[model samples]
Every structure is written in C-alpha cells, then in structure tokens.
Target: MKKKKLLLTTALVGTMAFGATIPTSLAHDALGSDVNKGEERIVFSNEDLKTLESSLLKGRKNVGNFYEAAAVQIQELEGVQNNTADVYAHNGYAYLGTHTANGGNGGVRVFDLKDPSNPVEIAVFAHDVPYTWQEKVIVKSVNTPHFKGDLAAVSVQQTSRNNSSRPDSVGGVLLYDVTDPTDPQKLGFYQLDRRITGTHELYLTTQGNRALVLASSPYADYYTHGENEDFQIIDVSDPSNPEKLWGSDPRELEEISEKFNGYHWDAPDGHTRPVFNHSVITDNNGQYAYVSMWDLGTVIFDIQDPENPVYLGRTEYRDDQKGAAHSAALARGGNILIETREVSNPVGDGYEDAYGYTRILDIKDKTNPVLLSEFTTELTYDIPETSQGRTTFAKTVHDPKVHGNTLYLSYYSGGVIMVDITNPNNPTEIGRYTPESANVWGVFVDRNYVLASDMGQGLKVLARGNKVVNNGKGR
Candidate 1:
C-alpha cells in the first residue's frame, strides 16, 4: 500500500546552490505535475519543500485568500532563490508570488488562498522605496493585480536588470488596501519621475466608491534597459488614497515590425507586442477594458467612468514587437479579445497545436481591432524533435481566467486550459483537468475550486465532483 510518487517528468534534480547548475532553462518542470492516475493534484516541489520541511518547521497555521496567515520562507526576505516558492492565484483566493527565485532581484509575494491546497503567507510587500535617507531603489513588480471587491494594485518598473542597483530604470509604483491580507497596509507608492522604469501591468477598474489603476510598462526601455512603456492611470478612489491621474508611454514600440497587416514577421516572435507586463482583459460587466501592448496590439479601454479612461483604440497585430502581447481575454459580454503568445509558438508538426493558440479580435471597433479567427488547441502534444520544445513540458498559456462563458487558461507547460466561449468565434476546447504540473502560473475559478499556481507545485486545488468529490461537508 504505497503510492504517492510525484517526482515528475524527469525526476526533478534541481535544488540549485547545492552544486549549482540547474538551468537548461530550469531542467523542465523540475519535478512537478506529470500526473496521470486519479488526478487530483499537488506538488509544491523541492519535493514538497523536502516533504514539507518537517511540516513546515512544525508551525502549522495555514488559512488563505487574504491576510495570508503565515509560514515564513518569505523568499529569504525578498531575494528568492532555488526552486523557490512559485505561487499566484487571484480567485481561488487572491494571491501572487515572486518575492524571489525566478528573477534574482524581485519583490511582491503574498497569499491567502484559503485551502487552495494550503496557501497562507500573509504580508511582506517590500519593493523598497525609502529614497530620502538610505537611498532606496528596488521595488520590482511582477504583476500584482487583485480585485475581487476589495483592493490590491501592484506594478513596479525599474530594470536595467537591477544592474547592481542603478543604470537607470525605476518606477516603483505600489498601492495596497487588501482589505487586510494579513494587513497589507500601504495605501500608496509611486516613484516614477523618469530616471527610467514605469508601470508594469494592471487592469482593475472597480466601481461604487470608484477606482482606476490601468498602469503599463510594456518593457520600460524597449530592448533591455527600459522605456517603451505606456499604461499609466491611477486614481485609487481612496483605498487609503493614491493618485497618479494620467498616463502614456509608447516609444513607437521599439520598431521591429517590418509588417503586420498581412502576416509575415516572425523572429522569436511572441508576436511583436511587449510592454504591458502581463494582461488586462475585462468585460464580464467590468464595462470593457482590454489592453495588452508590447509590440503594440491590444488596447481597447472605456471603463465607463472608472476614471477618465477612454482610449477606445488599438489592435495592430505583429509588426514584431518581440513577444509580449502575452495574455488577454474579454470573452463573456463579448466584442472579442482572446489573444495569446507568452513566448510565441509555431514549431509546426511534432504536433503541439503549435503552442496553445488564441487570437480572436474585433472589439466592435474601439478604434480598430479585427482579426477574427485563430484558435486550434485541444491538448495536442507530440514533442520529440530531440525535445526541442524542450522536454516537452506545458502550462505557460500564462494566465487567463473568465467564468461565465469559460476561458480558464494557465498553460505554462500547457495544462489547465479550458476554453468554451460559448462560441466567441468557435472557441470550444471544452473540459479538462490535466495538472501534471508544468509551470502553471496563476489561476483561480472558485465555486467549484480549480486554484492553480503550481510551478514547483505549491497551490493546486481541483475539486469538482464524483471521483471522491466531497470538498468535505458535501460528503
């Protein structure tokens, strides 16, 4: 009676620092989510942090969704390393991570994913903006967009890679009122006076008492240094009070698209757009706000009055903005905007559905966004060109979750994908639950549970029904 094996795909051998070298781009999934039998998942890897480090150092206290209780491992106080602690969810209980690990100098790692496979790390929003006395600079942002009725808007921009401190690039904008995710108290943080660096990515509009936050830093400086940005609008109708007002940064999108109206521009092309850190798809009643912008492609905003937002224009596909139109969706109250391409995918044949497709534009003429047609993914995998697709892992469809009409995509190694836009131009991939744990970066469905975010396997809660479906009590 012994079966709990979860060493995944190639038996994850990455512990970093313990003899160095673990990068072939992270030796594929590094032991996480290669699941098959019974299939209810969990793999918070590092071998479940080495079998839960003696039950997380015997501290207990695990409750989530907001004010993330506590468990330490604070990514070594915001310098994360090794297989690290990759966790991010926004609905399966509001969370986001990267206080360290994947990007050397990083910030922002919070949680409260209440029982979404145990998420509880309450507070530590140190992007460091002291400035005056100790001269502070590091406040890096990796997309902290949360709004399930409360507040938590984060998107810092300052990267000459960190260049050991400063080579230019710093726009550490931060705002929080998480209603109290273990006390997130920091009503404001805006340090973008242009020495470089700008808003990373945010798309929250909020109503009632009002809120704005649109932010964008498409890549702050074009190529590497930072500054091709444009996505600035912060008027936090007082979540403790924060205000920036107007915003725009579009250095003509670093100019790499020789052509983008008839197709024919592909060079490591995640399809030209690369400025908006991650996403901004709204419209399930959020009024209508879809802004992707990297190589410059998806920008359709009109947030009723979420504060002066009226850019109603953009949809200029592939002039080669260099892979950053990343992820987007507006499915439900549909006008169309389901874009993809976190890293461009078209390795033909070997059948991988050419990398989780999604391109359906035509935002009912918000200036102009009409590409209507391009979606072909139903779990196609064959990878074996010497594993050029690299050990063939999947789950980087990179964040996309909508419910009413169904969109749910987290595909880092390509798993958690379940489109069914009730026909948003034939987008019907339908039912799925494939968590063999590739790098499924962030997702949250709630009501029926789905809470994903299993990079090294940290937050994976399936819960639907049948095969032992009780979610307890209902048992």
Candidate 2:
C-alpha cells in the first residue's frame, strides 16, 4: 500500500483556533445539538455569534497557506444540516441541502447566495419517506463531465426518528431541471428500496448525455434498522424517467455483528446485513469516485467509465478490523481519500472507545488503497457516546470538508477542527472552535470561509473578520 504524506506540519496539537467571532460570550457555542423551544432543531445563529470566524490558517512552510483576517459572517439558514454544500457556481448559483425533519418532499431546500451573507431560499423538493428526508443537490454545467446544463441531482433522506414513514428503501435521488430557481421542476426520481435505506450523500457522474447517479443508502433509517442498510448504484441518464440499471447486487461484503460501538446494532446475535455506501467524493476531473464505504472504509472506484463503476479497492475504517467510515472526501489532491471513521449507534461503549476520527487513504494504487494518517480529539463528557444525535443525544465528528489544501471539519461536541493536510502522512490541527451549546453535525467551506451546520444555531458562517474597509487612499 502506498502512502501520501501531508507536506505540511505533521500534527499541530493544542492550537488556538481563529476566532470566527462567536462573541467571547457565545464563543463556547457548539455547531449542532440545540433544542429550540421544545423539539430538537439545527439552527445557524448570527445573534451575538458574529459571522467573521477568522483564525490563523497554519501549515508546514511549503505545505499550504490560508487567509488569516479576511473572514466575515455572510448568511445563515434554518433547516439544513451536515455537509450538503453545493458551492460550485453556475448561472445564478448557490448552495443546496436536505434540511428540515429529514423526510418528505419538503426535505429539500436551496439557497441563493448571489449575495454571500444574506442567502435566500430559492426552492425545495422531496418525496415522503419513512421519516423526515433531507437532501444534497448540484446543478449541471460545463466543465462538469456530463455538462448537461439545467440538470441536477439530490440524495434524499426519507426516514428519521421524527417520522414513521420508514421507507422500503432508505430513500431515493430526485433529478431536477433548475433552470429557473424560482420554479424548479422534478425531472425524475429513483429509489434503491432493497432494504430500509437512506441515500445519505451521493454524487452525479458524467456518463454520456445522461449522468449516472452513484448513491449510498444508509441502513437504520429509523433507529432499529441501520445494521441491514447497504448501498446501490443507479443509472439515471434519463432524468425525467430514471432507471436502476445497477445495484440489487450481492453486498460485496458481509456485516459482522459484534459489540463494537455499543449501540444495539441489530443482529447482535450474529452479523447483520451489511450497510454499504455513504460518502462519495470525486477526483478533480470527475473521472473516478472515492466512496466512504461505511464499514468497508474508503473504497476507490474506477469511474472513468461511470455506468460500469468498477470497484478498484477498499480500506477498513475500523481498522484492518474494527469501527466504520461514515463519511469521506477526496483530499491531498485527487490521489487521496479522507475518511471520517465512526459508528451510527453506540450502546454503552466508552467515549474514547468510540474513537471516531479521520483517516487519509492513498487511492492511487486503485486495487490497493493505503491508509496514511488518522486524527481524533478528546470527546467532551457531555457529547453523546451513543447514537449519532439522530434526534436525541448529540456529539461526535460527522463530516469533513476540503478546500484548497486544508480540511475543515464539524465535530459534534469536539467543535470545528481545522487540519492542515499539506502532507497526507501527518495532519495538523491548526485551530478548533467549540461553542458550549453547539452540537456540530456538518460543515461546508469556500475559498476562505467555513460554515458549520449547527442543528440548534442555524448556519454559522465564519470568516477571518469583517473585511476591514480602508478609508485612506493616499496614505
């Protein structure tokens, strides 16, 4: 197995995070896990939580360099949670997410960020599911492999603890024609209903004229079913009327039932049906797809040919043996895949034992993906050590986002951790932010800004500082 080293600092521990301006008073605020009124809701607050979240962007000399003080708070949204960011601009583009209760047609929402700070909701789309459904979407454009303008895809979360609409499958992907953001049309939708699965996070691959939708179906849409969840690859070339040309195949791997994370991961008596699929990030060219294959770790696929997604290799998130990879992103350039290791449920497992973390995998070898480095912070005593705050107990790092050469993460209770991965081998935590009440669920970043999808706080846009406007011209 080959390894990619983080050209930057090996590891920057106990570092002070750039202040995203969450008032020193609310500075200890967390990103997610907030109970609004009575029900648990993900909120991004600007009240007293200043927008400018600027902290020093660190790295090992030749590794990487990010802005320090230019950060500013731009906007905040109420419902979206997790890394459902669609920042690539096209037309009057912005960001999109699967928000609200997580299921139903209302699960989908979009923001118009033509104005960076004040993001406006353009549209929403979703179909009913066993629970509340959430979503992720991207509009097609040139430069993209398929480059079919006006086309886009969204992965819907059809089930959650909030609802009983348990899906025959977790959920499905909906194709849309968003030429007119004000009035978007649902072109098509397809479900991988083999088990009660949720298409957590997925991406559209440029195949031919039609894009192939590669989605991950998460098991346990409600609370008792994740053990049997798995993944499926669908062919939605015909958006208006998509088809499941693939999937329904044997779960390449079997899920072993063990007292791992503690959660009552069903099938305790024996190995439950494997829950495959999850995070799927692509190379710069969109030629290949790197997926966070849940218990399978990070799997690299040779998608040079999208339709026949040839599986090249797989990595074990738990180890050559234990835990699991919940979400992953291609980092350290296209050759490496960054995997977020975790378990959906932890019954009585010790917090430290849960050991959720991030791993860097070398995917250049294809058939033999290699692990480079891993990082984890000490969990707070209050963070949930059980089920990932589905709608209850909270805490744990859920998603990691890569921008430039640095990686920004949303830690459930650990707060926001920024790592410098100039060298994949040794990642450094340049800074971190953990507000007292924040239960961070997901994160998204652009050129120089980071946004934490806080369940109770709204959308916290962090930047260096309010861009200081200079008045002196001829100083």
What TM-scores do the predictions have?
0.29, 0.67
TM-score of decoy 1:
0.29
* Model 1 C-alpha lDDT per residue in residues 1-475, reported as the tens digit of each score: 1112111111111221121222232222211111110122333433344333221101011111111112223334433431222233454344544312343233455656555445565665534542111101112122223333345666554433344455444554566655555666676665565543445456555544456666654433332222223455666665445666654433222333223211122224333112333346566455666767533556565666544555556656443222335557665457667787543333432222344346767666666677867655533334345645433325225557677767777665554666666667676665444433345555666565655554454445555433322222111
| 281-343 per-residue lDDT for model 2 (tens digits) | 667566776776454457666666444556566675331223456677776557777777653
What is the C-alpha RMSD, rounded to one decimal, of candidate 2? 11.7
Stretches of candidate 2 exceeding 4 Å from the true structure: 1-92, 99-105, 127-131, 142-147, 160-170, 192-197, 220-229, 248-274, 317-321, 344-352, 380-394, 433-436, 464-475
Tell me the spans in candidate 1 whose CA falls farther than 4 Å from its real position.
1-40, 43-45, 49-107, 110-123, 126-152, 155-212, 215-233, 236-240, 243-299, 302-306, 311-357, 360-365, 380-436, 442-475
How many clashes show up per model?
A: 49, 68
Per-residue error (Å), model 2, residue 348: 7.0
Give lDDT for model 2. 0.50
lDDT for position 77 in model 1: 43
lDDT of each: 0.45, 0.50
